[model samples]
Each structure stands twice: as C-alpha cells, then as structure tokens.
Target: MPAVRTTFRSQNHRGRSCRDFPALTVTFNVLQLMTIAFVWLLALVPLTLMALGATMLRAVRPAAAPPGAG
Candidate 1:
C-alpha cells in the first residue's frame, strides 16, 4: 500500500462546506429548471393542439344512427 493523496479539496468559509450555494448559483439553478420546464411544455404544445383539433372535428358532426333505428 502506498500513500494516497486526494486531489479535490473543499472551499473554506468559517467551517462551512463548499457546497453552500452563492446567490448566482441559486439563480442559475432556478433559471435552468424553469428553462427545462418551459421546453417540456413547448414540446407538448403540438400534441395539445392536435387534441384540440380533434375535439373541434368531433364537435362538427355527430354519429349517424343505423337505418330504421332512429
């Protein structure tokens, strides 16, 4: 076994962990999450429009009854 050395070290701030987020980090995270959500909804727009069109088409006509069954 040889001496093992660690390359990554944490930042120091009054014994606080480096993972503590600054204002910019939090803002970026929120923006990134919102962007992803926005893209997801944008991707669904086509499908939603198709469904609306189908509903409109359905509203345009009713099913015809069988002969002698009216």
Candidate 2:
C-alpha cells in the first residue's frame, strides 16, 4: 500500500507540473508573433521611405518634355 501511494504521489506531481504547460506555450507563441511583426515593420520602413521619396520627386520635377523632341 505504501509503494502504491508513493507512485500515485509522483504521478500527481507530474500532472501538476504539466498544468502550466499550456499557458507557457501560449506565451511563447505570442512572443514569437510579436518578434515576427517587429521584423516585418523593420523591413517595411525602407520600402515606405523609397515610396515617399519617389512621390516627392515626381511632385517636384517639372512636366517639361525631353530636350531631343523637336
């Protein structure tokens, strides 16, 4: 009976440890998502700047034709 009680106790402890596993998994997934979003935002900065620069250049340039056209 004592050995059986010991086995049950050990099993109970193992189960208790696993109770927090789901919450940890969720937290890990959220962190990974945040990291991915940060990387995407970093990548977007250069493209956004390039687009803005192009728009500004077009706005500032004169609409005159090329010099070679008679």
Top candidate (lDDT): 2
The regions of model 1 sitting more than 4 angstroms off are 1-21, 63-70
Q: Candidate 2 on 26-55: residue-level lDDT in tens?
A: 898999999999999999999999999999
Poorest lDDT segment (10 consecutive residues) of candidate 1: 9-18
| Error in Å for residue 21 of model 2 | 1.7
Displacement of residue 28 (Cα, Å) in model 2 is 0.4
Cα lDDT tens digits, model 1, 1-70, are: 9997654655544456536768767898999999999999999999999999999878755555456664
Model 2 spans with C-alpha error above 4 angstroms: 1-20, 63-70
**Cα lDDT computed for each candidate against the true fold:** 0.78, 0.80
lDDT of 1: 0.78
